[model samples]
Target: MKTTIPVAVAFVAGVVLVVSFFFDEGTWVGGISQEFKIWMTIVGGFTILLGAVSITRVNWSAVQRKKEGWPYKLLTLISIFVMAIPSVLPNTWSPLFGRDVGSIYDWLFTYLDSPMMATMFATLAFYIASAAYRAFRARTAESTVLLVTATVVMLWRVPMGEAFLNMFPGDIPNWLNTYVMNGANLAVQRGIIIGAALGAASMSLRIILGIERTYMGKG
Candidate 1:
């Protein structure tokens, strides 16, 4: 009974939204769809609050238990509060406490957060390069083709690639990279997107029909 009501509401909402897209803008169905979209945004904000509450509860519990990595969790909790408190302060109080430009939260975000993000991305680049080196093997025909194409694309983007290619008469590498990326790669990307959309539609239909009971906490 608990799951049935929510499932019915979801099914009706989904059908209304799908139909609204095809209906005229001035129609009642379209108006209802617009209202539903506004409700979705409100629900999204509440979901963020729920997520914050869940994270705080878990981190506080870990800190209380003195669990492994509790120090990090505590730091995370402190950081969240530090970042949030300033934003919630009154505009009048914010300027008095230097919470506008050189404020604690702003400084931390600018100097600390920015550097941390850059460092993380730099670290990820190394990991990506390592993964690429391991994966780019010429074991099969497909792998050979992929490795060659990737090599050409990477080289064509750099000055050295252009320099090397310039030595050989025609602009073969440039043409190959441009055509493969814009033509072949784009077509594959479109195919993947279409497949994903179809898969999502199938899943949505299953949920609407009550065939996907997994969403209702049932295996």
Candidate 2:
């Protein structure tokens, strides 16, 4: 009964949203659906405190265990408290002591967090390029066609690409991308969209009738 109510509500709302596009008269349903989403978001924000508490508990326990990078854990706790405590009780903003705690939090995210994520992604670029190079090698005629098409499109994506394409008679890459690659990409994307929509619809139907028991957890 606990899981049933929320799941039923979600399924009904999802179906209504899917149908709302086809019927102008059902626009009121869309407004109500959006309002429900806003309420859910507010409730979810409050519920997230539970997650914050859990994270703190787990990280603190790791530090107590004398795990590696315990110093980093200490810094994380400091950062959380620095942001949370200030935001809780109001205070003045200062560039010296640190502007708004929110601003400091934003700075931390934009600078420290974003750079770490970017560096990790930069590290993966070499490996991705190596993998693509290995995969692009063709053995069969069908493979050759796919490889050539992919190569043409890839070269056209850049400025120096024209240097490579100059080997061809005319604007071969532009013609291929505009006429050939564009059509193939669109067709493949549409097929994927249709398959995804059908899959979602089937799964949603099962959920609505309670065939999907995974959401029930223990019971």
Candidate No. with top lDDT = 1
Scored by Cα lDDT, where does model 1 land? 0.85
lDDT of each: 0.85, 0.76
What is the Cα-based lDDT of residue 97 in candidate 1? 38
lDDT of 1 by residue, 11-119 (tens): 8888989999999879999999999999999999999889989999999999999999999999999998888778567657655233567777678778998899999
Q: RMSD of candidate 1 to the true fold?
A: 2.5
For candidate 2, the lDDT comes to 0.76
Candidate 1: Cα lDDT at 35? 93
Candidate 2 — which residues are off by over 4 angstroms? 7-31, 46-50, 67-102, 133-136, 140-142
- lDDT string for model 2 (1-219, tens) is 787786787677667666666656447876766766788798899778988898799889988997999989988888787766545453454442343544665566667778998999998989989998787678999989988887777788777886788688977777877777678788898899999999988887777666775766733
Clash number for every model?
0, 0
Please give the distance, in angstroms, between residue 119's alpha carbon in candidate 1 and its true position after superposition. Answer: 1.2
Candidate 1 backbone collisions, by pair: none
Give the TM-scores of the predictions, in the order they appear: 0.88, 0.72
